[model samples]
Target: MGFDADTGRLDVTPESPAYGTKLRWSAPKLIEAANTTVRGANMRTLNVLSPAPGKAGPATAAAAPDPRPTMPVGPVHTRAPASDGYHQALAAHQATRPERHVDPTIAQAIEAQTHALRELSRRAFPDPDPDSIENTRAKRRRDAKATHAQALRRARAERAQRGSTAAGVQAPSDRRTA
Candidate 1:
């Protein structure tokens, strides 16, 4: 569309894209017409993937940048590589390799290590015992009984020494009692 001298509005359409896009109408010197076409193409492809919040239409001026990349877009193209037989020759070449040697001692050691690890894993990491506390309590009780018996023997020996000093006396036979 041409300029509206009375309203001062530049009414634009798609065919007149070469004249200038939305950004050029607002800031004429900001970008060129070729740059605007690439940007338009980028927007079209990008919109196919993650779309805008509301892509039903595009705004004349956006507050944020579009999903379109800041780089130039081009058509996909590839050239058939000139073959020099490099890969084919390498594939046909024979490699000089050696056989794997297994030492009997080292093999036995590895086998033993594997078996030990297997046995360790087969057992529970934390063994569950029904009377774990009872075992500890029994050991403590035995220790206490031995200590009490020793104390009693010492006491009887002291008494006998005192009696022998006054008269003739001997300590009683040791008896384990608890």
Candidate 2:
């Protein structure tokens, strides 16, 4: 008598006449039957397949509670803007000053220095040809050593003029000096 009529399922009763009927239906038919608007409409159409003879068949047990799978359902995160108030204030302050592009000659000098450093870093550590390559490498090594020594002196003088400390000293160029 206990039936979830909304889902078209009927509980088996000992006194029910159709206890041993063989049940067979496609998914579409079941869906169609469950979707009916009328209450207890066409109840006889549902087949009950169980309990061999005069015995009443036990009703289908209550469906297992649907354990809905967990889902990633949260607001997406966004990164904060990189520029802070201090940067904005500094930028605003600098904006009042006239724009000064790098001098063409100075820019060219920097580019040349960068190219030289790149070339130095690319040079093979050991001379591939002991005679010709060794001579060229020796000259390059001497030139690089002298250039580094001059840069160090210049940096030391600059730091002295500013009364700055050089506790953690670093080279002007990252490439090997020689």
Q: Which candidate tops TM-score?
A: 1
Clashing residue pairs, backbone N/CA/C < 3 A, model 2? none
Which ranges in model 2 have alpha carbons more than 4 Å from their true place? 1-130, 164-178
Model 2: number of backbone collisions: 0
What stretches of model 1 exceed 4 Å from their correct place? Answer: 1-102, 113-133, 168-178
What does the lDDT come to for candidate 1?
0.56
lDDT to native, each model: 0.56, 0.60
Model 1 has a clash total of 0
RMSD of 1: 15.4
lDDT by residue for model 2 (16-81), tens: 234233124343465466557555454433444444445333542343345698666986669766
Using all chains and alpha carbons, the TM-scores for the candidates as numbered come to 0.31, 0.20
RMSD of every candidate to native, in Å, equals 15.4, 27.2
- Whose lDDT is greatest here? 2
